[model samples]
Target: MPKLLASAYKELLLLTRDIGGLAVLFLMPLLLVIVITTVQDGSFKTIKQNKIDILLVDKDKGEVSQTIHDNLRTSDMFNIIEQSNENEAQKLIQNGKYQLAIILPENLSNDLNLKIAENVDGILAKFGVDESEDLPGTIQIEPKEVKLFFDPATQFSFRNAIKSGINQMVSKIETKSIYKAFQEEISEDSNEEIFDTESFIIFKEIIPNSGKEAMIPNSTQHNIPAWSLFAIFFIILPLSINMVKEKNQGTFVRLRTHPVSYATVLGGKAIVFLLVSLIQFALMLVVGIFLFPLIDLPQLNISGRLPLLFVVALFAGLAAVGLGLLLGTIAKSQEQSAPFGATFVVILAAIGGVWVPVFAMPQLMQTLSNLSPMNWGLNAFYDVFLRNVGFIEILPEIGLLTLFFIATTFIAIIYYKRKNAV
Candidate 1:
């Protein structure tokens, strides 16, 4: 207990003396949380902000053309500005005021009318009515046409969504046209239904999550966990540097002669840093809760599984501590240890999705991310924050992180014994 407590106090005193390191421990993560949260907020702004602005030129001035315009406007994904001339629409697109332009030819309505006429006559002939071609005032009709002009810079997903929506709208109009023709020719007693907007079939769509809207992601959910995990791992650099410093000063060599065992010495270092890490986790949550409102971001929300939250934090801290122990024992000098230790943590953070969401990563990279302990910590936090689940839901993540701590600690202890034996 004497060596353990003394080592813990020494670690804290050494950390307090390094003002610059102290700033990085607290300030840098805070700054990054604020900045990255703001960026993600902007990047993921609601579907309203994601809308593409399109200049719509309605040269046809027909019902079908206006119908398409109205449908596009109804969707939150598009902002349609109607214009009389294609040239003006193109100019507006060139000025970058719009990302897309659509022009409908004047013949769309006329062609549809002619098509309906032909369909109507054919149906009438099926009932033994003839001489449809002999009808007066008829002219050859062409196919309906509309032209889409989109900026090359538009996102493929967005551009494709617009295209698919328009295609569906056109199909709907054509289906209705066919239905109208059938109604004129079919008997009242006939129950066949190709298009029944009123009675035969009512279109009802079931949205996911039982029609409950998905929660839009907020800054706190991400920043709190991501930067907190990152800051915890950064313990490596300082812990490694201090170990190298003690070895340089001959303190490490002398520890061997003392009655204290190797496990006790390493345990003391782990205990001290684990406390520091727990404090770091609490500090980030405090900043998110008390300080976030000044900047308009929502505060961090802790789940009802309060003890389980600490369980996640504890295991995450232990895993980081194990890494620090390994780094501290392996390197012979501060110069050799500190930079590599920090860089290694950062790389883990990046792959583990501290800097970005795992969902956003490529398929192979997402699979690789699971190898990181940071990923386990993040999933556990997300279960608490996003899913609003209890301890049971995060058991797998907790288990993995705990296992990681044990394995790394065992390996580091064996290596430390080997190195000191020489």
Candidate 2:
């Protein structure tokens, strides 16, 4: 007990003296979280709240074009600007001045109405409802094309959404025109409406909550947990570098002459570094809770999930410390440990859904992400923070992290004993 405490005290002393290392462990992650959250929040707002400017060229100059314009204007998704020429609208879209442009072909309204009227007259005549003998013969009318121009930089998904929306709007208009034609043919004597144009099916979004308050995940919610895990695991760089330094400085040789096991030495480093990880996590929470609102970002709401968050953070710290112990044990010099530790942490974060979300990744990458300890920690954090899950529900991820710590620490101990056995 005394030996362990002494070892822990020595590690703490060493850590406190290295001002630069302390700053790297603490400051870098806060800046990363804040910057990433701010940028992502802005993107989210742009997609959901901001309206896009679109150019409309109505060459037809008739009811169909007017209806299209009115529908687009009322949708609230676009700021429609009427352009006189299709070529001008195309030039504007190509120059990236606007993301989208709609060009209604000349005579589109006349051709569409003629086609509908001919079809309706034929149907009514077949049903013996057309009393007039002067019904016009079947006339072939070519399909009118509505040309859409998109900016070169437009995303494929955004383009597809625009195309679908425009298609649906046009289809509805055509259906309404058919209904009016049928009403004119059937109810020529009466002025009663035949078809209801109102939509019956609509979509509603449902967010799962913990029975207290609805927790809609924003950029703050996503980024805080992701970057916090990144910061925790990044402790490996400093922890491993410290180990390499101690070895190069003959501290390990001096400690070997004393009555101490390698396990005791490892325990000491783990305790201090684990505390550092926890402190890093706490600082992140503080920044998220207090500092975010000052910068016009959403405040992170932990509410009743603080204890569970701590539990995940503790285990995540253990996993990080175990990895550091293994890295330090294997690496021969500060040069080797520092770069490798930093790079490996980044790779882990990349695969762990820290940078790109797991769901957004390709299937093979998503499958591979499960192997990362950071993924386990991030999942546990999300379960507590976003999903509002309890301890029992988070056991799988917590268990995986615990096992990772045990395996890495065990291997590190074995390797150390074997290396120094002579």
Candidate 3:
């Protein structure tokens, strides 16, 4: 038993000596908080910094066509790049120099003219849609019409601007086309009556339900869970490296010869690593709750959700330790383990939406994220942090994670036993 305490003390000292371990335990988590907060600064600041670079290719020189180009360029949200050709514009967009490319067809004027004629003919031929002939002369052309091309990943404000711009252009085009037909009619002296008309275009609207007042979960709330899961999961690498260092330094073998049962040895080491992981978890939770407040964190209320939230954080840490132990046991040296451990952590974090919000991810990638612990952990976090849920809200997540921890620990033990036998 004396040897066990000495070995545990030795393990703690070895961990202290590791500069990287010290950074992970004490510094990196704080840095992550600072980075996440200061990176965007604030919403208004972000919007002010946000401007979409659009590549403009004006293949058509017609007044109407140029009007479309002019309108888009005059926008504060869009910064126009006058590229030589569509090919160059597309190259710039692909190279990430431009967020979107606007391609104006050489025959856009002709197309507009042709469409207007068709529309006028359709209206005149209608049975009861129009009955009067008070149609006005030539369509009015605004000098500020413009077309826009947007990068799919452009900021939300810019995207909305683009949508508005599109509607504005279409409405202007439709109005001008109708007026041109009326002008032709006035010049030729129409015999029958034609009705004056104005109609609104049926443009579609997209509204994201923020539910800020109602406290319902929204798309952005998922980021809190995803980021927390990945951040906690990443602590596994430091934990594993510490374990592997102990084994390589002959500390593990010396502890193995102790009079205490093997179970006790394993239990003590697991407890230490679990404590280390929990420390990291605490840092993340503190940063998440107090420092970089997410958009819609639920108020700490009468809901018994704090316990569930803590459990979620705790279970996530435990699962990470189980993974780290498995990884550490499989590698004979820290050098051998570091690469695989780091790579696996990165891949999982990326898949779990730590690198980018899941809402921004492609559908296929979003579906695939479910295979990682990041998904379940994030779901549990979101349930508490955003939904203001009770313990029941996270029970399924807790149950699943408990099963995962047990399975991973079982595998780690099996592999370690096999390694010992060898």
- Considering summed lDDT, which 10 consecutive residues are worst modelled in model 2? 206-215
lDDT of 2 by residue, 1-422 (tens): 89999999999999999899888889999999999999999988777888888999989999999999999998868989989988888999999999999999999889999999999998888888888889876788989899999999998989999999999999999998998889887886547897787777888997767574668899989988899999999999888988999899999999999999999999999999999989999999999999999999999999999999999999999999999999999999988998899899999999999999899999999999999999999999988888888899999999999999999999999999999998
lDDT per residue, candidate 1, 88-111, as tens digits?
A: 787777777778898888878768
- Of 1 and 2, which scores higher on TM-score? 2
Tell how far residue 9 is off in model 3, in angstroms.
Answer: 6.0
Given candidate 2, what's the lDDT at residue 178? 93
Q: Which order, best to worst by TM-score?
A: 2, 1, 3
lDDT of 3 by residue, 217-293 (tens): 43224444455566677766776777787788886787667665444554555666666766665665565556554
Q: After aligning candidate 2 to the native by TM-score, how far in Å is the CA of 354 from where it should be?
A: 1.1
For model 3, what is the C-alpha lDDT against the true structure?
A: 0.66
Best candidate, lDDT: 2
**Poorest lDDT segment (10 consecutive residues) of candidate 3:** 295-304
Cα RMSD (Å) between model 2 and the true structure?
1.9
Instruction: Please give the range of 10 consecutive residues that has the lowest summed lDDT in model 1.
Output: 207-216
Candidate No. with top TM-score = 2
